[model samples]
Structures are given as structure tokens and as C-alpha cells.
Target: MSSLVKNIIRFILFIFFQHFVLDKISLHQMITPYVYFLFIIWLPFKMPRTWLMFIAFLLGFTLDSFRHQPGFHAAACVLIAYIKPFLVNMLIPQEGADTNYQEPSIKSMGGPLPYFIFIAVLCLLHNAWLFFLEAWQFGNIWYFLIKTILSTAISILLIFITELVFNRKQKFRTNTI
Candidate 1:
């Protein structure tokens, strides 16, 4: 299947699973597992910045619509989408890199350590921005901090489990019109 088609399907499935399954499960008021961000993180390396942000916005907006929080998810998603390139560049060194790792995944990232770091950093960023925005105040800093940490850990674990279970290398073929 084409890359576009694969991504489209992934987008739908992630949103559906997040809203129906993940959102309903309340481990606590704080530690919510968010696998939806994985969709944005897994996007192709060569995707243009504008499109990436646009897609992130759409993904977050969809969740916002469902959850009744207007811009929290949208803003957080866009923030990570904006930072994704820099984070990938920082974690994946330029020396002797494999060009074929076109998307962010365990195989593409060389090993579990680097991939875990990448996911952890982004998950922390996402959870921090998201929970803070939801809180809308620094009055309870510790609350937000603990919430962010717990949520990030859960999200990272879920993401890794997802990667392991469906560990298929995606092949992207360019089409000529």
C-alpha cells in the first residue's frame, strides 16, 4: 500500500482507539495513556513542516472536539510537531546514518535506547504542555508535574508495546504522475 493510504488508516485508527478505548480508562485523574501522539511521531521523515503541523492540528483538534477542551490538545500537538525535526536530528547522529529509516521507529532509530529517549522526551513535552494547558495555572505546580511524569511514563510504555506488537517496517514508494 501507498504511504499516504497507510497514514490515513493509521490516523483513523489512532483517533478511534484513543477516543473510544484509551480515553474511557481512568487509572487515576492524572495518568491517562495517550497513544494518539504516536501517529504524529511516526510520520515520514521527508514530510514538509507545514503539512506535519497541519496534520497535528487536525489530530489534536479531533480529540479536542471529543473531549470538550478547545485548544489544549491542538497546541500541545503542534508544539511537538514543530519540535519533532529538531529532536530527531539531535537524537539520531548524522555520522554513518541509515537513509532508509524514513520514519521514527525502533528499527529506524538504531536501538531501543535512542528510540526510548526520543519517545520519552517527546512524551514528556507533550504531557507537560497538555496537562499545563488543561490546568491553566501554575498555582499547583507539583500537581501538574506529577501528572505529567506519570502520564508520560504510561504513554511511553504504551507506545513501546505498540511498536513491538506491530513491528513492521513500512515501505514508502514515491509515485510519478
Candidate 2:
């Protein structure tokens, strides 16, 4: 399928996975792993930073509306979205950037090592912000730390599995995407 088609499907599937699956399964005192942020991470390498922020806001806002969490997720998503390009540059070193990849993957990004680190950082950031906000009123440092680590691990594992499963092999070459 085309990159556009794959991205649309990725967006929808992630929403369903987050809202219907992950959101519904509350871990209570434990951590709740979220894989939905993959949508933001999987966007084309050369996509505009501004557009990434917009889509991140939209994605988080939609999830917040569904879960009635107001601006919490939206805020975190925007933060991650804003830094995505910078992080990608640092981690992947886009001399050729493989723009048509459509999603961040080992096959497209050149190897599994850099891609894994990139995904891990984003997952940790998303989980840390989310759990920190959720635990704000309570003010439990341990919970925040534990939740971040646990949730990040789970989310990263899921991301790895998803990447392995789909394993798109196409690469899009462009200037500094």
C-alpha cells in the first residue's frame, strides 16, 4: 500500500488501541502502557514541525475528549511533538533521512539501534509527562517514577513488536528530512 494509506490506517488503529484497549484496561496502582503516541512518532521524516505539532494536538485532544481528561494528554502530546524533529535529527542523523518511510522503522531509518533509542526516548517522555500530570494532585514521587518506567517499558515493547510485525521495507530519500 501507499505511504498515505498506511499512515491513515496507523492513525486510526492507534486511536482505537489507545482508547478502546489501553484506556479501558486500568492498572489502578500499577502502570498503564500507551502505544498511541506511535502515530506521532511514525509520521514522515520530512514532515513540517508545525504540522507535527498540529497533528499531535489533534490526536491528544481527541483522546482527551474521549476520556474526559481535558488538556492533560493534549499538553504532553504537544510537548513531544514539538521536540520530535530535534530528537530525530540527534538520533537518526538525516543526511538522507529516508522520507518516504512514512513510519519510523528499522528498515527505513537504516538500523534497529538508532530507531530503538529514538522510540524509547519519545515513549519515556510521553509516559513521564502523562503519569506526572495524572499524579499531580496526589504528589507521590515514587508513583510517578515507577509509573513512568513501567509504562515506558511496556509501550516500548509494544512499539518494537509493532515495528517487527509491519516491518515496512521502503525508503524515501530526500534532502535533510
Candidate 3:
């Protein structure tokens, strides 16, 4: 149907999948692949920054409420939300950007390389903030680094897989009565 409808459904599905499936999978204490942030990352490019941040807050707060954490995800989500626009501008040059593309994706990003870079940087920042906040101490740098890196890698992998599986090439149709 419409893009708004699709995104609304996507938001629900991402929350359900993340909280039920992905969160339950514990490959290790240090590596939990969080693919939920993909929802925020995939939001329409034209969305206002304030609304983006608010939505990110809600997503993260919902997760925090589920997991019994105190704003770790919320903080990380806001961080990425705040930085996303700048990242988009930096990664996708105006001359090269496709105006028809509504959000960040491999196709919209022009290729796997730029998309990968975009995802990688955001995922890294997200994981780093999340793990650091969870730890709340710099007493163990290695612990933070290992956990952040592993989790970011797995999250990125899952995000890419999700994108490949679910990403659709949209078309606009005109109707005449």
C-alpha cells in the first residue's frame, strides 16, 4: 500500500522480532545482535529531525522497559538519531543522491559499499554507546571493546540480511476514474 502504512507495519514487526526473537538469542554474554535500530535507520529521509529523535526515544524506551534497563538504549538511539542526518549527507553526496529514494538502503545508497559504510558507522556508534552505558565503568576497556565490536558485527550482519530479504523496489501507480 502506502509508504506510511508499510513503515507502521515495519515498526511493529521490528519491535516484535527484536524483543521476542533476537533478544532471546544469546550466543555469548558479550554478543547480542540488536536489529531493532534498523527501523530508525530505515525511516524516510525527509522526516523531520525532531520527529526522528522522538520516535527513536520511543523505540529505545520500549526496549528499556522490556529489558529493565535504565535508558541505555534510549540514549544510544538518540545519539544515532541526532547523527543520522549528518551521516546521510556525508555518505550520500547531493550530486549522486537519488531524490526518488525515500530512505537509506543499498539501492538508494548507490551500492553495497556506501550502504555498508553507513550501517557500519551507525551500528558501531550505537553498540559502543549501549555497551558503555550498560557497563557504566571504564575499569575494563577490553570488556567494553570486545563486547561492542562483537555485538556491532552481528547486528550489522542481521541488518544486512533483513534488508536483503525485505527490501522492496517501490513503484508509484496512477489511477484515473
In model 3, the worst 10-residue window by lDDT is 168-177
- Give RMSD (Å) of candidate 2 vs. truth: 2.6
Tell me the lDDT of model 1 at 141. 81
lDDT of 2: 0.81
Sequence-dependent TM-score of model 2: 0.88
Residues 56-96 of candidate 2 have per-residue lDDT tens digits of: 99989988998876888888899899988887777665564
Model 3 has an lDDT value of 0.86
lDDT preference between candidates 1 and 2, better one:
1
TM-score of each: 0.91, 0.88, 0.91
Against the unseen true structure, what C-alpha lDDT does each candidate score? Answer: 0.87, 0.81, 0.86
| Model 3, backbone clash pairs (residues 3+ apart or across chains), number | 0
Model 3 segments beyond 4 Å from truth?
94-98, 137-139, 171-177
What TM-score would candidate 3 get against the native? 0.91
Question: What CA root-mean-square deviation does each model show from the true structure?
Answer: 3.2, 2.6, 3.4
The regions of model 2 sitting more than 4 angstroms off are 1-5, 99-102, 172-177
